[model samples]
Structure formats: structure tokens, C-alpha cells
Target: MEPTPRPLSPHLGIYRWQVQMVTSILHRLTGIALVFGSLMVLAGLFALAMGETSYTAFQHFSASPLGLILLVGWTWSLVFHACNGLRHLLQAAGVGFATVVFIRNSWLVIFVSLVLTILIWAWVIFGGAL
Candidate 1:
């Protein structure tokens, strides 16, 4: 006797996307990006310790377009991870449990993170005095 075919289990396509879900995924992704960013930071420090020549090379790379793009992405990742981490801490304390509140806070985290990233870049570009 032949076996009958079974219906596939629910997957990504089966569910409507939600803010909380997106935030959770982004939190994990940003955590990973931060790890790579930290490695880059370590490399820069190591170059500095080596001497002026090595440090200058690191600085040159950091000033390149690709380096600037990575820096921007790292900045956003840091901001998003920090905001979402605070949200997680609040949830752990039993705050924002209501569905509406949770969704609202998720969007709040995203908005605040973007605003912070933009503000930082603006300051770097336009603010003259340190």
C-alpha cells in the first residue's frame, strides 16, 4: 500500500509579519553584528599598539568608503541592540505585557534607534567643535 501525502507544517509564508517578531529577529542579528564590530575595534587597537605606520594604515582604511559604510551599519546595530535590550529587560520585569503596549514599544525601539543613529552621523558630519 502507498502512503498518503501530508500537508506541510506552517512556515514563514503562513503567518502575517508582526513588529514584535521583527524586533526579536533584529535583536539577534544586531548582537552578531556587534561581535564582528568588536573584532574590528580590537584590530584597530592592535594596530595602534604596533606603531605609527600600522596605525596610519588602519586610519586610512577606516576613512575609506567601505569602512564608512561598515561604521554606519555598526552604529545602527549598536543603537538597535541597545534599545531592544532595554525592551527585553522591561519585559523580563513583567512590564509592557499587553499586546498593544508590546507592539507600541517595539516600534518605539525602532524609531528611537534610527533617530539616534541619524543624530550621531549628523553630529559627526556637521558639528565642528568636539
Candidate 2:
């Protein structure tokens, strides 16, 4: 008879959260969000092609307060994913993976993501883009 397999070791729930972990989790989450967001975009395009009334209705819903909040959240999610993606790309390319480099780059990703989100929204609000 074959011996029984051993149990798996501790995973995500067993450890305190860190920047690297946050980036890892959010990467997957943002990917899923992006898929749904793309579907929304396709739906809007279809609606636009249907008629002026459909397009106007889509626009009105998109301009609602809740819609605006979701837009901001999706924007930030995209920014976060993009920032961490660059970090991962650097590691994959044989750059910036030393202990100190990893630590510094992790913080850099977090900082730059925040800055990009703020700057984008600032432009939307004050630059007459919104």
C-alpha cells in the first residue's frame, strides 16, 4: 500500500500582510476587475451603436455619483497593477532583485501608484477633463 500524502504548509492566512503580498493579491484581483470593466466597455459600445437614446442613457448612468466612485476605484486598480507589473518585469529581466533592491522597489511601486492616482484625478477634476 502507498503511504498517505503529507498536509500542505501554512499559506496566506497564516502570515501578516506586507507590501509584496499586497501587490501579489491585488494583481490577480485587478486582472479580474479589468475583465469585467472591458465587458462594460463593450456593452457601452454596443449601446452607442444601437441609437442616440441608448448612448445617452449609458452616458447618464456613467455620470452618476456611484458610477464616478467605481470609475475612480477602477482607475486606481489599474494604476496599482501597472506599477507592480513593472516591478515584476524588472525581476523577470534580471534587474533589481537583490534584497535591498527588492525592498526599495516595492516601496517605490506603492509610492508611485499613489502619486499616479492622485495626479490623474487631479487632472480630471481641475484640468476640465471631468
TM-score of each: 0.87, 0.83
Task: Kindly list the per-residue Cα lDDT of model 1 for residues 11-127, writing each as its tens digit.
Answer: 867779999989998999999999999999999999999999999999999889999999999999999999999999999999998999999999999999999999999998989
lDDT leader = 1
RMSD of 1: 4.2
- What C-alpha lDDT values do all the predictions have? 0.95, 0.84
- Candidate number achieving the greatest TM-score relative to the actual structure: 1
**Model 1 global lDDT (CA atoms, 0 to 1):** 0.95
Q: Against the correct fold, how does model 1 do in TM-score?
A: 0.87
lDDT of 2 by residue, 11-115 (tens): 978988776777778788987887777877897999899999999988888789987887787888889889889889989999998878887888888898889
The residue-level lDDT of candidate 2 at 52 comes to: 96
Superposed Cα deviation of residue 44, candidate 2 (Å) = 2.8
